[model samples]
Target chain A: MHPAPSVIIFTSFSGLGFGLLLFLGLGFPPVTGWVAFVFYAIAYALAVGGLLASAFHLGNPQRALKAFTQWKTSWLSREAWLSVMALLVMAVYAFCAVFLDTRLTVIGWIGAALSLLTVYSTSMIYGQLKTVPRWNQPLTPVHLLTLSIAGGALLAGQMTVAAALLALAAAVQVAHWQVGDGALKASGTNLATATGLGTPGSIRAFEPPHTGTNYLLKEFVHVVGRKHSRKLRMIALTLGYGLPVVLLIIPGAGHVLGLLAVISHVAGLVTSRWLFFAEAEHVVGLYYGKRSA
Target chain B: MTELPASTQKKLGLVIDLDTCVGCHACVISCKGWNTENYGAPLSDMDAYGADPSGTFLNRVHSYEITPAEGPAQLVHFPKSCLHCEDAPCVTVCPTGASYKRQEDGIVLVNESACIGCGLCAWACPYGARELDALEGVMKKCTLCVDRIYNENLPEEDRQPACVRTCPAGARHFGDLGDPDSDVSRLVAERGGMDLMPEQGTKPVNKYLPPRPKQDVSHDMDILAPFLEPVAEDPKGFLGWLDKALEKL
Candidate 1:
């Protein structure tokens, strides 16, 4: 609920796009010039997609420029400003690469920061929203940060360090997700306990206060209501994570591991993000007479 | 060159005594009265008096009967609207300049002209404070009667928010929350006030003092006896069929 696909795509693509550019510029070069150019274009698409999607969430997309004025206090405004700054950095880097030269020392720092900020701000957007307690925690930002590094690592050429970082991030992510799931369960238990109920069982009720479904229920309590999809979710995580590991080290992917790495990470992340939003319980859900699961 | 314009200063807000609010919704009606005429557009009722009655209101008084297992039913009337937080999240979340927290006095106002009618602020609010005015296609909320509070034509004391002015029980109070020594601040301090949803961390300036009036159930022993009946029997109204069907079959 805290994140939309625009945000998801922005963080992931920006990471890959900027990450590839930075890695090639810093560690390896000449050969990855082609990769860098392609990634810059990919990064641009993702960033613009994110910006457009974010605009829809705004009351006035045309007046979004005003967000730059409040960068001192608001994280969202800072995000808007930083995103624009990132685009400029990217454009300049591209220009210099073609004619003059993309300075590894100067533009590298900018690209790195752009990737970091793109992911960081995207994380902070949800991290700051206090209403959704699930997202308000620091783990939200940490998860996004790790995700950036993971995306960057997947784009690595030969260094085992990249794979190591990816593995470390995956571990942290799994641990954090476990903690989050525990927190969610604990809160549900606490709510049920507070109402003098023992283990929430079949607490469904009718009589929604509003006639038409409001945005809250639709977005937050978006239970699929189908048993089959739940099974699909389990498989998504398994295949997403499992296949990538197998493809990376099995020595069969040849030079194609890079592409597979990108696909697997994105697929796994999409599944995780979907579960993250789907599993969260809104306090208002209780008012509609929802029993704790 | 230094410029200083002479403008009358009035800190606008509402103070509801949780003890006295009878849940009759009189303030809600009066609020509807004032905003209907003064606001850019009226709060629309989707289906008035129908099966599905839902609409927008500047104020709504909710009656919650808080019953203590040891005692009787204590009806707590909560009239909720915009609390006008000192650090308003709704204003901050707005991607457009439509939502603004006025520096003049910390009143969170949404400019209808500039608003694109995005509901981000509504989600940001844990208290469900802001509502999108479907008729105007813009965000609308309790303005604290800003138009009337400084109308100048009305008497000095009469120029107050409709919620404060029309509260029959004198439960609602309006004053400057910024001033530490203001009446509203003092009332909050003296009454040990709490907020509607404090865990939200929005730091809402508006405070609701505790109203734990004990209700006596001693006189209604006969009526209350049924409440203690076995809850497992037929909460869903299916126990009768199972009991009768067994004998018939």
Candidate 2:
């Protein structure tokens, strides 16, 4: 897992953006006119900007339109379709709320559901990868969904709901790390199984295929130091979940505190998202003798 | 279109013999040479002669040392490429339907023209078989030399994968594994050819023949002791007289 910057930005911002859209679509803030316009603008910027950031990682961004065609099997395709639909539906809903001062309950509800589904689709893109054992778990979707909804509640200024959701997000994130820590070992894909050489007493990498690095090694064989990752986990938890919950729950917390909470949460989200890719041990790394699958 | 067919008509793949591979990497070079020239995209290299050289290669050979329970350590040269699995994850994970397994021959291939180069297919593969061409920005993989295998232009003997044709050790075998009676299938049956990472449940068509047990050659040194014995304990005739004369002198 390369912990690619484009993907980290894409996942973190898009999750937050869609989460906010989900709240706005359901009339959480219930604001009208320019206030509603500001909310919609932020949501569109985050969501659309995140999607565009994802395109930056693609080697051939020009052919990305073709990515929409394989939703029948591919989660990435499902994500493209879902994100577009969510954005389009939210646009219409936002227009009505901001300009027409009308609340169409059915359209808003549909948009909210689509927005949530878009985040889930994005999560599934990683969750479905059996090659990366850390992400191939029910907890993966649970973590992403909780984070998105919690972030959405925070942006909507629903302090009580945001507090509770942030607490829940913290719990899910911890549980995800707890399980993901041992996922590759639990996968039972060691060097022996990887090479089908188990009959021997033990197998060790005698020599590598090439002296220079290749795509597989560069992409999948990332090695994050244990001590460094531990420190990062603490930082992510304190900023992403702990601080936000505390800020939202404080008795006299005002606009400034709320803004600080949002900033802290975003910073935390980016850090954790970086860890998400960096810590994932892809089974393919076993072939390179870089790690135990 | 990313959905796999119910079953391919033929499971055409390679059966590699781990016992015979000498770790020469000949197949690797031959595969690169043939594929770059013949395949959809020339497998491009970035900073080929410079500091950080990296490139896309469909086939690669890795060497490993295995210590048997009772005997000495053995080195095995493992050559890996696309397994062309019956349940190929790379095919189903493709967002653009560019990656697909042939319903006719079971050869998994990327339609490079349609490829978005998102690289999800590469991530989905546990074998690290597919590589994205840095220059072309399209995925490259082993087509089992689809062009050469089926080409009417090549000689009948040359109608096989470039790696298979170029392997000097006769370690690489190619045929339909779907047919139980095929030479490859029979070889698999006799040698107990095993799939790599069977628990992944990809149901790989390719098989690997495990190296045969080795003999400990330490005891063979005793047989050469007879050659080191003196030809005669006592010299005869002139040689015996010369020996006594030299002793007197």
CA shift at A253, candidate 2, in angstroms? 1.1
TM-score of 2: 0.96
How is the predicted docking of candidate 2 categorized under the CAPRI scheme? high
- Per-residue C-alpha lDDT of model 1 across residues A35-139, encoded as one tens digit per residue: 556655665665566567656555445666665765655566677787777777757776566446444467756766765686677678767766555666778
What DockQ does each prediction reach against the true complex?
Answer: 0.17, 0.81
lDDT of 1: 0.62
Tens digits of per-residue lDDT, candidate 2, A188-264, equal 87889889995423888889899999999988899999999999999999999999888888898899999999999
What class would a CAPRI assessor give candidate 1's docking? incorrect
Best by the DockQ measure = 2
Highest-scoring model, TM-score: 2
Please give me the DockQ of candidate 1 compared with the native complex. Answer: 0.17
Per-model C-alpha lDDT, please?
A: 0.62, 0.93
Please give the range of 10 consecutive residues that has the lowest summed lDDT in model 2 chain B. Answer: B224-233
Which 10 consecutive residues of model 1 chain A have the lowest summed lDDT?
Answer: A190-199
